[model samples]
Target: MWLEIGRQHLSLWRNIEIVMVNAMIPWGNHLLLPLGTLREPFSALKRADVVIVHHADMASKLEIQAIESMVHKYNESVPIFFSILAPSHFIRVGNISYTCPLKDISHAILLCVSAIGSADSFVQRIHKMGPMHVDRLDFSDHHSFQPKDIDIIRKRLHKLESDFSAVPMMVVTEKDYFRRPEVLEHLGYEVLVLCSSLQILPLKGCNEESFKKCLRQHLEIYNLA
Candidate 1:
């Protein structure tokens, strides 16, 4: 049904020449079900033209090789790219929205709140900002923050101040920030939302220019067709 819809759209729009499907595979010991976050079997990756391995930087060299080997075992010729999720900026949740650099949060004690798939990665990225400490409050993916959750956060903040003798800043993912902006703002404390973006990792034998060229080559083929 999806393919039919794609065909119909292609018929209507002459410019629609190529269709690419991406599979988001994170770095983990298992790429299949029963243990890790993977919903589908690694064999399903055979259907993908390009496989993107996210959190590439988080994986060690040995782990990357293992993942690459596993992927090649299934699909030898498909282009596999590595990517890292880097924090771009922090959004201040208040009357007037503003952005701050990660450097600004340095030496700060942070209360990290997130309901993302990879909560540990989020915390690790926050630590990369050189914060003095990060007290994480993780939730299941897309879990909405409730009043009780807010209460828990407040208690944690108080504990942080009492323990560290420093005012701790509240940090959240951008997704959570947009989900409950008003709730977070009314918490009687300042909140800074971290925004992240993906960055492609250069291959072992490829330079930036060459990798960019390879990306462009894929799109350039459609124009010729």
Candidate 2:
């Protein structure tokens, strides 16, 4: 279905196909459909004129090389770029307009709560903030928080507070907070929403400027812009 849609777009003569890949699990089990995480076969990468790898910060150099090799296997000349979700700031849960500094959690105990695609990446990033200790409550991607889940989170937080004998705060990704702001606000505890934006990583001659230049070149090639 997606290939058909891409073909339809390309048939218009002004469209260029770009594919985004998650660096954490590029090709889950290398299987397709219900058996694995991929929607299409790896060979489908041949259709992509440009490919951007997300969460590049979390992946190691070897992993990126493997991904590049795999992409080149299908399309040797496809332009590959790397990007990371750079955490910008934090917003208080109840008051969305109130922004908090990333250092606010420094030397503080935090319970990282998230239901995102890359929970490990989110937690690891938090660890880098110099938190006294970080505990996590990760749910499956897009899993909505239920009453029982709330109870579980509360219990975990309570345990952390008791163990550390300090006030433990809750932190969640922007995706989780936006999914159900009211749910987090009602937790009756300090909950912060970590916000991040996509940033181009400087790797193998790829940076913000080069990424834009490449895009412009592609646009000129396809006459899209």
Candidate 3:
């Protein structure tokens, strides 16, 4: 009875046996989904038990509020909530946890990035890693990458992996890498990726406890659980 609401293939919906819905399902070079339309129809919101909103940092406050409003409007009976995202809670780097920072992150090289969750937010979370210097290759949520595409990416990485290159490694979000298991193809370059979770400190109402509230909100909606 769980449904993962997204624009396309997301890990949360990957192994789900039931039918899944998406806003925009990518098909090769084309998008096959209608934006904002749900497969269950608007009336199905009545069965919803919760409404979770996210992307507070990357999106404007108005945007987040708008999402909340949309969810509430669709399922007024459902309890609206928030949940923290990966990289906001902590990052697992090669089986190790590392505290992420907003500044002074230009230390790691070659960021192999992918996410069935939030690619933008994850990339932004590691912005301190570099300014336009990071190898930012994002895949669609649960993207069944084609051999051609993977080859292209490998070639691109090979071409980009050099001493003068920005970062000579691959960084990926743990979500995608864990699911497909084919994302570990950084043979000729240093590999770097987000491991597990990260702690986030919001700029507004900045406090440990209040931040915890926001974190909870993000997790409730964003997490597959």
Candidate 4:
């Protein structure tokens, strides 16, 4: 429909092809669709010319293979790339802030706060950073935190410390910090904000260069025209 509309309205434009219809499927092992977190049935993959499995590094080999197999079943010809959201650095939330390496938080008890749709993935990524422990308090996606919410987080952090007998550090996603900077700042503890970026997994048949070529070829058409 988009192609037809583009052609109808802008017929003078030349050589426009929908080179690829890419679909992003987060690394998840669950029941298909209705029963679980899947946005669509595995069969829906047939429409995708390329599939990106994000957070691939966090998943076990078996889990990765399972996801790959499911995608191949629906669309064997479609190229599937495994990708990881690797953490780059931690930015302190305050008036005068500094960045730290992910390893700097090693062995520290963490109170992870997030309202992201992929809260489980956030927790997994945080744990992978080698923190001694992570206790997550999840809210609805894009939840604008209120004073009551701050209180809830404080209570959870205290509980985590008392139960584990360790002083816990506060951690939040970049989104959470941007949404309510003042609220997190006023809280009596230092908060660490995590930043991450996509790192394509280099597999046997597919690698970073190959993935870049695929994307470049798709967009090159527009560039040339």
Q: Which candidate tops lDDT?
A: 2
Residue-by-residue lDDT tens digits, candidate 1, 1-225: 001123324247543222122223343455434575555555655654455566767767887787678777878986766667778888888843577988988999899999877788788888888988889999888888889999999999999989999888899988887887788877777789888886776767644466467668766776788
**Candidate 3: stretches off by over 4 Å:** 5-39, 88-111, 115-117, 128-132, 144-150, 162-167, 180-186, 198-225
Quote the lDDT for 149 in model 2. Answer: 87
Model 2 local distance difference test score: 0.84
**Candidate 3 backbone overlaps, count:** 32
lDDT of each: 0.71, 0.84, 0.49, 0.72
Give lDDT: candidate 3, residue 141: 65
* Cα lDDT tens digits for candidate 3, 1-225: 124454234344432222222112211122222543244444444545443334344555565566556555656645444334545323334433454442334665545557463466666666744645565777776775566656766776766656445645566665665664454553445444555443333444344466556446646665656
Candidate 3 versus truth, CA RMSD in Å, comes to 8.3
Q: Is 1 or 2 the stronger prediction by TM-score?
A: 2
List clashing residue pairs in candidate 1: none
lDDT of 2 at 136: 94
lDDT (10s digit) by residue, model 2, range 75-154: 99999989888999999988989999999999999999989767888999999999999999989989988888889999
Alpha-carbon deviation at 108 in model 4, angstroms = 1.7
Off by over 4 Å in 4: 1-36, 41-43, 161-166, 221-225
Over 4 Å off, model 1? 1-36, 206-225
Between candidates 3 and 4, the one scoring higher on lDDT is: 4
